[model samples]
Structure formats: structure tokens, C-alpha cells
Target: MARTPVLAAGGIVLRREAPPRFAIVRLRKRNEWVLPKGKLDDGETPRDAAEREVLEETGHDVEVHEFLGTLVYDSGGRSKVVHYWRMDAGGKPVRALMSDIREVDWLPLDEALDRLSRGYERVFLENVGPIALQAAANAERERRTRLRVAAAERRRAQPAEQEPAAGAPVIAGARAADPAPVRPAVTPEYAAADAGEVAGREHVVEVTAPEAPPSSAREIAPIAAVVQPTPRKNLIERVRDWLRRAA
Candidate 1:
């Protein structure tokens, strides 16, 4: 079976002002703004390839946030599968100096769409834009959650710092103090009086036990006589009958 031609592609939404914008890299030779992408090397995963390609094609270091989708296209009579990803560039921009990449430039989405050479590249941009936005949102939410958790942890930690020193007595002269509050004791005479009052109340109870009737009176039928037999023969008898029949 022929192997699938897999390529890894990465695009950055380089933000300058509010509502951060995507940074499109322009090739030095062609001066065409396009997403940084490259074919996957042996043993390299799609994510690793995408990151490598983005770094190689663009001077800016990037961290991949999420996978965008796969793009299938025909190249030199072979089907090429390009894995797309949303990436965030770290710090300021740098120039891509690889042999294949002539130069790199960051462009706004509108400018990039106008300057990009291929129509398919526009489709890739469209697909990656929403995913990148969602990734940014998720990152913001995670940051907020972490901040809240850290604040809660700090609050929890503060109590321990403000707490009294360990082994310190809670009450001064506690051992010499008169005594803690005590409940009144119940005298035996009082308890007996209470019990006598309770005994005066009328009540009835019904109880039964499996005791045989008096022998002098009459005998009752055995419990076995009332029980009905199941359809199947007992295992012990069946085994014996089987053995006898076999013999």
C-alpha cells in the first residue's frame, strides 16, 4: 500500500492592537503573503512539523494552540494532506532565513488576503481564524480560572499565618479555673420514681416464638408436611440413580 503524503501547516494570528490580528508571512522571492507550511519529515508528528515549519518559515517562535483541519490538494499528480493548526507567536517578530523561505513579514488579515497568491490559502485562513479565536478565548478563560484558584489559595494560606502559635494555651489559667459547666446528677430514687410512672401506663405487645406446644395437649403437623416439592429431583438422588442406571 502506498503511504499518504502528509504535510504540516501552521498559521499565526499575530495580534498588534485589540482583537489581535493574525500575522501572515511573506516570501522574500515572491513577496506573497501566505501561511507558513512544510512537508512532514520522517518520524516527525503533524504538530511538531507544523511548529517547525512555522518557525522556519517565520522568524517568530510560536506555540501551537489547537489543530485546525486537514487540507487535501493535488500536487504533482499526488494527493497531499496538509494538517493545519492555530499557533501563537511568542515575543517580537523575526525574519525567516531558511533556504526555502526567502523572507518573512507579518501582515493583517485583510492585507494578507489581498496579497496572498492562492485561493486555497484564503480558505485555510478562514478555517484557522475562528479556531484561533476560540483558542484565545479558552486561554483567557484558563488564565482567569488559575487567577481565581491562586487567589483562593492565597486566602487559605493567610489564615495559617494569622493563626495563633501552635502549642499556645487557648485559655490562660485554665487548669486553675473553677470548673466547666456540669449537668445535674439523677438520683437513684428519682430514676425509680420516673420508671414507676412509666410502668403505670397501659400497653400491649404481641410476640411469637418457634416453641413446641405442651406435650400433654396435642402435637402439631411438621413444617415439612406443609412444604411443596419442587419439580426437579434432588442432586444426591439423581447422582445415585445415574450411577445405578450406568451400572
Candidate 2:
């Protein structure tokens, strides 16, 4: 019987960082250290094969995120093509070796490119590195942005500072720079519709506070009649939140 041309699938499994590193494996019999890839099993898709091979070879679970490209090369007289994907390893490689995988290493992309035994693979990384680096920078920026936003939210979510005791004397201009407390978060759907923007575009809210009804149109309630807000629960609520997140 005539042998078929080779078909394979693999991944550039990353353990996410500033520069992004990839998982590499070495075979016990072979002196080469290369990406973890293998021929697909019967009835398997390229994505499934890639995920499965990485787990089997490196003992690490991963989810494929981006498709890199396909590489075609010759092995003996047969033509072989391997599809590559950019995968998130979820965590560090556990070195869970099956019968085939000998040693696994996580290396910086640039270093991995040089350490990889195949020129074709190195070239692939060279071409993909710039795009990947930009993505990493963007992700890092977004993460920091989220942390800042979360802090802002926590501050906003807090109840306004407690009023002084009923009999306490007011000091003129105490904490005057503290802005008035914000009311509520805008619903995402409203925000989305307000901007009518494509993905990655932000909605600029143009809130025109209803023209201050001339003083004559306003109801002047007695200052003492204003309902005082209740004091909010303190660290206990935060502890509950921390416990919830931990769970």
C-alpha cells in the first residue's frame, strides 16, 4: 500500500507573561527540542488534535486561542503539513510525560525560537513574534486598566462618608475637594446604544443635566426634612465579598 502524506496538528502553548513564553518538548531518542505536536487521531479536528497532543506530550491542559499558520515540509519522500495554533496553557506545564514525551521546558519566545531545532519553526516565531508581543502589551494594559476600574468601582460603591454626630460642630470647608457621591452605574445596554459604536469604540455619554429649573420652579424643602442615609456595613461586607470570591 502507498503511504499517505503526513497531516499533523500542534500548538504554541503559552504560559502568559509580559513577553509570553511557549511550551517545548524533547523526545528521549531524539536530541532535538521542538514544539509539542503529533499526527491527528482518527476522526479528530485540527483544534482537538492540537489540544490533545499538547496534553499528552507535556501533561498540561490548554485551550487554543489563535491560529498561527500551517507549515509544509518534506519528510523523506512524503509531503507533510502541520497546522499550528496559539494556545493558553491555563498554567505552568506539569511535565506529565506519556511514553513519548521526555522533557518539557517553558522558554521565552525569543529564546525558544533559538532553542527550537527546526529552522521552519524559528522562522514562524520570527514572523509571529511582533504580533504576539503587541497582543501581550495590549493584554497587560487591559489588565491594569481593569484593576484601576475595579478600585474606582469599590470607591464609588462605598457609601458616602458618615455625617458628624447630630450635636457635632461643622468645621468650615472640611474635605471640600471630595466630589459629591456618584449615584449609580449606567446600564451597559444603555451605554452601548448611546454610542452606537463598533467593537473597541467607547460610548461618550453626553448628559445634559436638565437646565436648572429657574429657582422659582424648584421646591425648597426644609434642610432638616432631608432623609439621612443609613451608615453602610463596613469590613464585614468586604470580608463576605472576599469569601465569596475565594469560594
Candidate 3:
């Protein structure tokens, strides 16, 4: 009869760096460097167990993501099964090392693989390391993209300044000059019409000689005598005058 496999869970915790690093722990009793993991507690789900175990072993808080893969191996006379999930650790450890862990070290994939005392773990990291790093890189890119979009939105939200009208004065150190007073322009025809209207309103005055002042004194001088008319000469005289002329 086949025996039931001993079930365990753990994390492949990654710390973000220039080239990312993976977490591995040294065992207290066996004195071997291995992936941080432990067997499941009674009634605990595999995912929760994976998070708890990683925290206890690595002494760093982690955010767990996708499931990596399973490792099936032999321990004593029983088959062992360990499930793993990809996780991200912060920059610094938040707690002390767990009693079962002598120390925890973060290393690059190749070095982490070589550092593991178990062959199965080395092979597992070899397969899953690229996947975890890629996921981290993709997430970082998405974060930067969101930040850029948010900045663009903030720029759009601000009010735009109104541009001054063309030909308007731009003063350097004082308020803009008040606009020049505008005069209504008139055509020559209108100016001529206005002049005619003013000329038409002029008045013409007629001055008669003033009446002679009343005579201050009564008239005293008599009128001069009129000359008498000449009398006609008698006919005889007229004849004698003619005879004389003849003689």
C-alpha cells in the first residue's frame, strides 16, 4: 500500500533590487542551507500555511502572489510534498529569525540555487526564479505607468492662464496701463454737415437809424422870403426891344 505524503508549504520570497534576490534559510538542527518552509499545521489551508511558514522561517513579512509549483521528494521512508508561492519581501526584516532557522540570506538566483543543500530545491528555483523576477519587473513597470498617468491628470486639472489680447501693453513691474480713450471717428461728409448746421444757426441783425432825439429847443429863426416871379413885358415894349435890335 502507498503511504500518504507528508504535506508542507513555503514561499519563494523575493526582495526587489537592481537584480532581484531570493530568500533562503539555514536549518538550526541539520545545519544545512535550504529554502524557508515547514509542514502544515492541523486544519490549516495550504496557502495560509505557506504565508505563515515563510514568515516564521524567513523573519520577513511577505506579500504572496501566484503559486509557483510543487516539489515531491522522499523523507525517511515517506513521500514528502511541498507547495510554493511567489512572494515579495520588503527592504528590511521586520522580526527576529525563527528558532528553527539559524540564519536567512538573500542571494541572486544562481547563488541561491547553489547555496541550497537540497537538489530538489535547487532545481525548483532554477525553474521558478525567472518567472518570479519577470512578474516583479512587470509589476514595477505597471506601477510606473500608473504614476505617470496620474501626473498627467493632475496637470490637466489645473486652471490655464488667460493670454493677453493682441497689441495689449505688457508691463514688467507695474499693473498694465489703462486702455487709451477711444474717440469716435467722423467722415469728411459728416464734418461738413456739422459745419453747415452751425452756420445755419447764426442770426442776422438790422439796425435802423435811431429817431432824432426830440428837439431840445423850439425853432426861433423865420423862413427866408421866396423870390417873386418875373412879369411878362407889354407887346409894344417887346416891339420896341425888337426895333432897337433891328436898328
Candidate 4:
């Protein structure tokens, strides 16, 4: 069986500030600050592999912003391509594990350039650094724009009041400004529909008369006593009585 190409991934180490910064991890044996990366597993894309590798190596979760570039170099006569990305790590860098990563640190833009391996520095400066700077600039511009718009709205709502001069317009245009009109209070009739009383007070159309009290025993007629006839004893007794009468 032919050996499969080793797919790997990792991330740019980040420095947190008003505008974030990027750096790389220093592997123990290699002893170089390079972008955190590892090989992809079966069915894993390079992007997913990169994110996982960065988190594993750096202990920093990051949002991948964009693909920076790719590195294609020969490894043992087989070509390997390492995909790079610009990411936002969202906070301070902390060293989590010591086995794979010896130490993790945040370097300023210029200092990061000094620390990264010469082989990868070209990629960092040419691709990743510029992209990160542009993103930071864009974020700053958006922040300033939002602040300006909010300040303008505040000023418009409540402009500074001027001291009244002897001949200055008496009301300062304040009274002339119309107050927001108050809506009239709703009456019970208008609200009655929502209350399920649309038929207006459910008028008792059929006023049934109250039932009379049950009659007392004194007012009721007495029940007559019931007399039951005595039953004859047997057929023999009946026949004897009939014969005697006949005789």
C-alpha cells in the first residue's frame, strides 16, 4: 500500500490588545517559534485540522478569519502543503501543556518577526502580518465611526442651553417645539371587546321567578293505610273447605 500524504494544521499565536497581535508556538525539539499546526485525521479538512491543532498546542481558542497562504515543501521526497490562516484569538495567550509546546508567548509585531523561524518568517510578514494589520485598522475605523454617530445623536437631542440676553428670543425656541402628543385614555367600551364582553353587560333577559319553598308535613295530606289480603295455605285445604261447604 502507498503511504498517504500527511495532512497537517495549526494557527497563528495571538497577542490581545485594542488591536490583537499574532505569534507562534515554540515546539520543544524544534526550539523554534512557528505557527501552531498538526496533521489532519481521516475525513478532516485542513481548516478544521488547523483550528484543532492550534487549540491543542496553544490552549487558545481562535476564530479563523481568512486563509493567509499555503506552504508547499518537500518532506522525505513527498510534497506537503501547509495551509496558513489569519485568526483572532480573542484574549491573552496562556501555556496549557508542556509536552508538545515548551512555552507560549505574545510578541509585538516587530518582535514576532525576530522570533519566528527564517523559513516561516517570509510567510508571516508577507501574508499573515499584513492581513492582521488591515483587520485591526478596519476594526478601529468602525469603532470611531460608531462613536461619532452616537455623539451627533446625543448633541441633537439635547443641545447646550445658552444664557438669556436682554433682547434674545425669550423662549429660545423651546416652547415652540411641540411636545410629543399624549394619546387619549381608552374608555371601557373600546376595551370591552378584548375583555370578551362585546354583548354589553350580558343583560338577564329571562328573569326566572324564585322557586316556592317545599310544603311542610302539616300542609301535606295523610297517606291512607294499605290493607293486603291474606294468602291461602295449600290446594288440599282449599278443596276440603269447598267440599264441606257443598255437603
- Residue by residue across 1-247, what tens digits does model 1's lDDT show? 6666656556554653455667666676766667778888889988888888888777778777767787787777677788877777777757645876766656656666676677888877766766677778788789999999999999987755466579964443334344442232322211222211432222222223336653421122222212222244455666677688879
lDDT of 4 by residue, 108-224 (tens): 777777778756555546566767678756766998999999999999999679777788545323443444332323222212222222323332222223256424432222223
CA shift of 42, model 2, Å: 2.4
Ranking by lDDT: 3, 2, 1, 4
Give the whole-model CA lDDT for all candidates, comma-separated.
Answer: 0.64, 0.72, 0.79, 0.64
Q: Put down candidate 2 lDDT per residue, 1-247, tens digits, no spaces.
A: 6668789999877777655777889887876887888998899998899888988888988867678888888888887789888777767556568787778888887789889898987887778766656665676699899999999999999999988889975644435454443232332222221222332334333323334542421222112222233343355565676688879
- Which number leads on TM-score? 3
Model 2 lDDT, residue 53, Cα: 91
Point out the higher-scoring one by TM-score: 2 or 4. 2
Error of 3 at 71 (Å): 0.9
TM-score of each candidate structure, all chains considered together: 0.56, 0.59, 0.67, 0.52
Model 2, residue 28: C-alpha shift (Å): 2.2
Worst 10 residues of 4 by lDDT: 187-196
Against the true structure, what is every candidate's RMSD?
27.2, 29.4, 29.0, 31.4
